[model samples]
Target: MMELQKASNGIFHDAAVEGGIPPEEEKFLQHKDDGSKRPEFTDFEGKTSFGMSVFNLSNAIMGSGILGLSYAMSNTGIVLFLILLTCIACLSCYSIHLLLRSAGVIGIRAYEQLGLRAFGQPGKILAAIVITLHNIGAMSSYLFIVKYELPLVIQAFLGLTSASEDWFMNGNYLIIIVTICIILPLATMKHLGYLGYTSGFSLSCMVFFLSAVIYKKFNISCPLETYGNHSVSTVTSDDTCTPKYFTVNQETAYTIPILAFAFVCHPEVLPIYTELRNPTKRRMQNIGNVSILGMFTMYFFTAIFGYLTFFGYTEAELLHTYSKVNPLDKLILCVRLAVLVAVTLTVPVVLFPIRRALLQLLFPGKSFHWVRHIAIAVCLLFAVNLLVIFVPNIRDIFGISGATTAPTLIFILPGLFYIRIVPKTQEPMSSRPKIQAACFSALGFIFMIMSLTFIGIDWMSGEMRSLGGH
Candidate 1:
């Protein structure tokens, strides 16, 4: 047990070595800090700040999910979407609360490790499998964005014809180039702390996207064709202009699932907690709060404005809806580039958790080694790029994975882990926290079954359902 703790310390020890501390001393220091502070402190004092942790976690939560949100809003209506989004956000926070509490009680920081502590090897393997699938969905989805959008951005910048068959315009080749030049370097980093700046920059791009969405709402007045002329060509009646407060349509079945997976950052949570500076359960939980709140605001505004601009005509991908106005429109082109960059940079942030889960499951006794790290990153990228390029129906992968894995990460695993890891003597089965956790786990089961049922019905009806075209 003590040896495993040392190996875990070694996994995160790359940054800690710069202080001139020997490996033995570092191991001893980790041991001292393990359970010495309080049961609340799940992590040691590292260099990552509160703001940076928020950025990393926030970046994880924000993804292709944002691109499809306005579409979700369009189907569910403004009022109903807000109600659903609020519930998902609050539930995500409570889910994080459950994880932090479970980790504090057990002093087990890795998600897989928590599973191991709870239900032995089978539990740990369950977590590892979930993370591998979930992040693979995430990383491929990001590259999927790059694969589809990079060519368009390149062509827009180069003033080339959209149908041009130039190598530079080939999305397959462009994804390869981006993977080699940009994502590979970032994903190979030893710790999540290093990606903070990239995360912040990625987030800044999304803010620009949000600003553009809001600006275009009033600027691109309805009878939406005027978006091409940049002038108000049609002054329609109030009925057409006013927002829909509530509506029910066939697409409504997929809206909640779309919004639900938007917050699937649970895999990244404990990894960030491990790298956090002076992390306590309360402090880490606060980080989750601020990040989720920021994204909630960004998601709501982006949806509301994008919906207002197009209303009922909004497409599955909001940017594509804008493309109808003018695909070559310069501002929309830049907006496409912004979304592309945001998701591209997000690929690396998603990689860390997957790498960690693989390491724990595959090389539990091995100390951190650069060869292992680089090999995993390179291999992971290669396979994901292949998946993105070769697979025409990548959304099915995301749809099935998102439907099953999102709820498991957000609700099921954390709730079950809390129940199993916390001692029955300390927190009795009938206690408030325990009762709440059991209910939470049960809710996860219900959500999973409901999502699958709706998705199955959609498929049976010959309407394929995917979360935001991922």
Candidate 2:
């Protein structure tokens, strides 16, 4: 019986094999560039450790959006926010591990490659589209942020209120920020290998911002004000009601998902894994564990502090939440200005992978130094910024960014890859579930529905508001 079982296993193993491709050579098949082409990871020069890898992950995870998370959580109440955070953090750990495990099996360096390995050509194409859409949406949101906020800084400096309304319309400032701050640094990088330092710098800015917020909240005794007309009203025996927890409802729930979406950075994990020093399964797990915990801490604090500072009075526009929080104090204002600049600088770092992935997807055979790819990326980024400046709508941005793209990239794909690739034996040890893949896919589907629904609702709301002249 043992001999029969061994023979059956042998046949199955051989059946799984393809042609004469050894396991080592099959790693290259993950790239599947027809042998005439090679991937960037083919010549990987590793310098990352578990600590540095966590730092990079944390930095990428903590981007410009951390500022807005608390405002989103404000209406939801602290308890609700904490619940969501806990759920997402645990989900993040499982999903990240699954992604890393997928990468290890196929030696794939990007999320798209992982899809290709598991699901073939169609899967690759779909993954590429999801990532591209995600990048476009995220970059557009960042552009809108710069368009709205940077002009205020300039206006304050010039002491001119007249220049404000025309800022996004002109778009030249947006162009400058996109080109000089984002495109140029990314373009000049001889290799993506050295961007870890930039990641380090970005993480430093995150720390600085958190510290500044904490200092202000502790030193100052400012209490939060009420937010929105609908803010939490309760009925009394006299038929009068008081507001509770700032009038949170389903309509105001848009910010909650958007906040979750903004905090995610799963797509960026692939590069860090490839860059790891030993690049072992153990090291990867360690990095994932520490990074998620670190980011959760960072985000939790940022949310709490932002909530404390603005309290229930926080604006729907997250940045304004900061702007209204007694910037008259020079120390606080300086910190605010510093954080803004830091986020502005870090914008380019985020742009790197998005640009690289888009370029590689379209031109798989092309080398990293291909000038045409750079030109195309630059052109597209330029056009995106232009559109963002001219047509800035927070609801539309969130619909595309958080509701549609974030869930697929973060939760859905990881879960799918785990089910597809990870063995059941390994799964039990790792503590990830086979059923989670289905659940994650379902979550992705729900997110897609939510995305479309949000888009429709936003449009309807806008029309009604136009009629009402809010």
Off by over 4 Å in 2: 1-45, 49-52, 159-171, 219-248, 325-329, 365-367, 370-373, 392-398, 423-432, 463-470
lDDT tens readout by residue for model 1, 1-470: 22323224444432111123234333433432234465433233356899999999999999887878888887888999999999999999999998987776656577887787678788889999999998998898888888878887887788875548888888899999999999999999877888999999999999999998998887775667644444433445566666888979978877877888888899999999987877777889999999999999999999999999987667778888787776667888888898888998999999999998898888774557999999999999999999998999887667778778888999899999989877776678999989999999998888889888887887898887675522
**CA lDDT, every prediction?**
0.81, 0.59
Summarize candidate 2's per-residue lDDT along 33-131 as a digit string, tens digits: 232443333324356666667766776666566766676567676667777778777777777777866666555456766666567766767777777
Clash totals in order:
0, 5
True lDDT of residue 403, candidate 2: 61
lDDT of 2 at 8: 16
Candidate 2 Cα deviation (angstroms), residue 17: 16
lDDT top scorer: 1
Candidate 2 CA-lDDT value:
0.59
Model 1 residue runs over 4 Å out of place are: 1-37, 40-45, 226-239
lDDT accuracy of residue 33 in candidate 2:
29
